[model samples]
Target: MLILVTNDDGVRSPGLRALALSLGEIGRVVVVAPDRNRSAIGHALTLDHPLRAEEIKPDVFAVDGTPTDCVNLGIHGLLSQRPDLVVSGINCGLNVGDDISYSGTVCAALEATLMGLPAFAISLDTSLFSHADLSVSTRFAKKLAVDIMEKGLPEETFLNINVPFGPCSGVELTTQGKRNYGESVVVKEDPRGRKYYWIGGTENGFEDLPGSDCNAVHRGYISVTPLRTNMTNDKTYAVMQQRSFACMGDID
Candidate 1:
């Protein structure tokens, strides 16, 4: 099997390299990732400017764009053979809860799923992004990869797995968790006494809900949440279908 590995954390990230090497044990590995950290870029693509992908090493390419770009280039243009699966991350930080909407790590997997490939995103929840942290996380990644190669995921879905900072007891099938976005932005002064805004800070708290990814991770279990490329709310869609909304068409 050919595995195309990419990440939002950049080409030189220890986590990215670790994941590539771990996946390498399973299949042929090709690493195409951002030349610099493109964290929290979401599913953005470079449209106005030409994207560049440089071969930094054997089977390793550094893209001058987002994680989404790396995956698109890796499968569509870079590789001679089609990749059987796409995997992103072993990211430096946790991409659980509401973080997924802003995570380029998750977006890379989304991009591959959009391109009709089986994909998964892995993240390790920790402050210590050391090689040892990666060692623990990549083990979970390898296990998931083996199961994916054997069982296969459903169409339009990709796994978003988040492993705890230390040893996890086990793994769980979970739903995306929710967390209140509090103190996400900070305002500060520059050297010139000018105001500058920082976009994000620590999240406050996770909802007290069961079977959520956050809960599983909090309980020292790896959280495997299957996310879909489409954001449609199937239950809401059915309910809306029964009601005729004037907004559905031109206003009379």
Candidate 2:
């Protein structure tokens, strides 16, 4: 099976390399990623400017774009054959709770899922960026990938997996959780006396929500949250239909 591998942590990130190599044991692996770190870029696509891609090695390419661009380009242009699966990340940090909305890592997987391929986003729950020996996580990813290759996933569904640092208790199926942040954006003056803002914050709380991805990670369990493409609010849609604001017999 052909497997497309990409990440937001950049091409040279050890997590990305390790994941690619681990997946190679099971299938043909191709790596296409950003040349530099593109963390928290979400699902941004490059349309304002021309995108650039370079083949640094066989089956490995670096693109001057976000993770979403990598997946979009890799599938539509780079790969000679369509990939059976797309495994994004093994990212440097966890993408739990509301963080998924801002995560380029998860966005890469989502891009693949949009193209009708089974995809998964894996992240290590560590604060340190240098922590790269993610053998355990890679193994877990390989196993899950194998299962997906055989059984396939539900339509429009992708898996978000977060691996806790150190010994993991086990895996748990979970739902997305709400994450509250405090002092996230900080303003500081640079050496040039210009004000610069840093966008980051510490996790405030998850309310210890049961069966939530954040709660599982906090409890040292590997959180597997199934995500889908549809974002429709059925209840709101029904309410709006009942309200009937539109004039049915207009244009007399």
Candidate 3:
């Protein structure tokens, strides 16, 4: 089996390297990632500017674009053979709740799913960016990758795995966490009298909703959430269809 790997934290990210190294043991692994950190970039594609990709080593390339670009380019242009699975991240920080919407890490994996391949996005939950041995997370990622390789995924579905910091006891199938990101964005002025913004805040630990990814992590457990490509709220759609805006009798 062939596996394609990419991340939003750029080619040099330790998490990216750890994931690639572990995946290499199971199958042919190729790494294609952005040249610079593209965190929270979402699923953006480079259209206006010309995207440049430089091959840094055998089976490893870096693109001057988003995480989505790297994955798209990997399957379409770089890889000599189409990959059976696409795995993204081992992201430095957590991507739970609404974080998935703005995560380039998840976007790379999602792009691969769009191209008809099983995909996964993995992240490590940590507050500080420090050197941590990723052996445990890498091992877990490899196991999951092999599982997908053996079992295969359902149509139009992808997996989002978030590993908690420190030793993990086991995996818990989870749902997207509820995040109360209070006053998250901070507006500021620079020394040159320029307006700037910093995205910063502590995650609210309080949520009545249990069995969420964030809650799981808060309790020190690895969270594995299955995500579907279809965003339609079937229950809500059914209810909305019954309510009509058209008038039955109107004066002409």
Best by TM-score: 1
Clashing pairs in 2: none
Tens-place lDDT digits, model 1, residues 94-152:
88889899999999999999988999999988655763467767877888888988999
C-alpha local distance difference test of each model = 0.89, 0.91, 0.89
- RMSD after CA superposition, every candidate: 1.7, 2.3, 2.6
Per-candidate TM equals: 0.94, 0.93, 0.93
Residue pairs with backbone atoms closer than 3 Å in model 1 (clashes): none
Q: How accurate is candidate 1 locally (lDDT)?
A: 0.89
Error of 3 at 215 (Å): 1.2
Clashes of each: 0, 0, 0
lDDT of 2 by residue, 31-100 (tens): 9999999998999999999899999999999999999999999999999889999999889988988989
Q: Give the residue spans of candidate 1 off by over 4 A.
A: 247-252
